[model samples]
Target: MEKVQVSPSRTGSHDQSHNAKWGIAAGFSASLVGIGLARFAYTPLLPAIIDAGWFDASKAAYLGAANLAGYLLGALTGRVMAQRSSTAFTLRAMMLLASVAFFACAFPVSYLWFFVWRLLSGISGGALMVLAAPAVLAYVPPSKRGLSGGIIFMGVGVGIAASGTLVPLLLQQGLKQTWLGLGIISLVFTAIAWKGWPKQDAAPVHAVQHPRQSNNTTLKALYAEYALNAAGWVPHMIFLVAFIAHGLGQGLEVGAQYWVLFGIGATLGPLLAGVLADRVGFGLALRLSFILEGVCVCIPALGLGTPWLMASSVVVGAFVTGTVPLVLGRVQELLVHHPAQQNAAWRTATVGFALFQAVAAYGFSYLFSYSGGNYALLFLLGTGAIALALLIDIVASRSVDEAAPR
Candidate 1:
């Protein structure tokens, strides 16, 4: 048998597309840095901010809650704005706004200013999340989607972990300058992403539409799942830093460990779940994720202390957060073969996605407040939410199977 040699042109074309895909992934990941840092950094920095008289403990709490509120609002509003423009355009706008909001923190002591910036950051972050994942998913083939999804979500963990490492260094630089540095970093990253990000004349194939069947059911179930998860996790997101500070009586440096653990766990969660979903199907993967998360949420409160506690936090973080890609993948599978004007159906599902997340954020904020600053209570609430989410997964899975073309 004669062996055939591959042509240089074909090899070049393949290489070019590979490069393009990698570029898109990196651009999307870079866009997440500011939000990731903001979300995870404060948990460690809260203690220092309070002790240094930068702000009160209560003010930090309020700022976090406000940020989540803005995130909720941003989610509901992002696609409407996207309709007026492109996701890239919207992303650039949000990034510019986020940069300004972050840099505004240079003043350090203005309660109102902090609140404003936090909220703005939340909006930028939320919009990034709502738009980025789906876009990233679109660039790759179905066969490699699990790996691609993991790579995309890793940005969240990377940003969080980087901030954890950086916050302590910033503290040494002093508060005002530290925040200013972080703000500058955000600006630089955004500028780089804006310049390097690719523009395609065609949108992703799956971007078009969803089926007109019982989408209402999908929407309802999605809303409940998002709401419950948000309720379960948002409080922890906002207050984890403060909780660590007070609960462990550790200095800021030590408190950074929680974020370190959380980031590590969150990093692993999406990758593992994506693979599981690809293998076992989306619904069953989601159910397992929720169960793992439920256990993880409660583990921290089961009187596990210190290093063991950190281990649990990491474990919990992985499963708790990893379910997102699988969910998005399921939606993509449903909509991939839809009609020519796929934007309408896609928009409907996207909008539902945003609103569900918003409701979750809002409801969870209230739950956080009601917990009266008790971390254990917050975790308990998360545990319950996970249980409900698991139930939703089972029901939704059964529905899909029953509704199958068979």
Candidate 2:
């Protein structure tokens, strides 16, 4: 055979590409199992728990909130844990913890026990959201990061869709069986992703020792935008189904169908948004997303009709999942060379998101009750929050430009 030697550069490139693929796969799995299955799977299960007499409706609602609280705590602490341990270790540990939590939930020994497990699962999801993409993206070329990030976040959508579709089928086998089924699925994903993380630990945190003041201002703006965006998402996430089912007199089946549409939109959103971001830039893509989502969010409030309602459900669902990667991508753009800082900043963003999401959940819940189940009010408020987020980003962009040395 003729001697054919591969050049070192080509071999290295091939290795890098291979590693990036596996790393992205791992990230996808992490998000799917941690956030998708761990957090969202609980939503569909909530009514089941109430119906099964496992817990009263009030207790079930409180139990659901426990996960949100744990998510906030996890976001606050994930970066610290990653710093102390390796990113790979922490990421793997969180995935494992999430799987374990799902299995434990199957037992439902008591409300306290279920709550603790649910809380732990939310913590796993929070940590994964903060850590997984950065870990994987470190291996991806900068040019391809937008699409790769979309792929990673697409897991959330997949999880959402699965919860809507699969959970019902799993419910057929019984509630405990459904929990076990989710746990098994999670465990399978964990095993597949076990060795997919990058072999080396993440780079140390010395990239940007002295970030500029403008960067600080921009970051604060991003945080506020993200927080408010979370608030904006609350109405659709919490009330869309009920609004359709009872508020519109559409009935439960029709409401669930809308939710399925939301899930489908969510599943496709990240990819579409990522591609748009890649072509138009994250900043512009993000602004466009907000505008589109804001409009869609208000459609229901306008009482347009079924087609418009469907559009609202789908677009809002898409933006809810799509905005994640756009924000994360924007963070990377802001801190291009600082991997550690990127992780830390993303952690802060996730914390803000979780915090505001919880607040909005409660606030909107109260408004819904106080307003006598006025779903349109909640949707309009959500739109206002999104519009405010857009305004903040616009102002922040101009300020950053003005502060730049021309």
- Candidate that would win on TM-score: 2
Could you say which candidate leads in lDDT? 2
lDDT of 2 at 319: 88
Error of 1 at 161 (Å): 0.7
Each candidate structure's TM-score, on Cα atoms with residue i matched to residue i, is: 0.84, 0.88
Model 2 TM-score, 2 decimals:
0.88
lDDT by residue for model 1 over 1-406, one digit each (tens)? 9999999988967865775576555544553554566555666666777788877666666666666666666766777676688776877787777777766877865788788888887777777766665554555566765776677677777777777788888889887777777778777777766744445423545344433543546545754675566566654565565666776566567667777777787777777887788689876676676776677677656777776667666876675457566666555555455544333444444445445445554555455567565677767767887788778867876787788898
Shift in Å, residue 64, candidate 1: 0.8
Q: In order, what lDDT does every prediction score?
A: 0.65, 0.83
Off by over 4 Å in 1: 1-19, 204-213, 216-219, 334-372, 396-406
Tens digits of per-residue lDDT, candidate 2, 110-226, equal 888988988898888888888888888877887897778888888888887777677778888899998889989999999989999998765544566545333477788999999
Candidate 2 yields a Cα-based lDDT of 0.83
**What's the count of clashing pairs in each model shown?**
6, 0
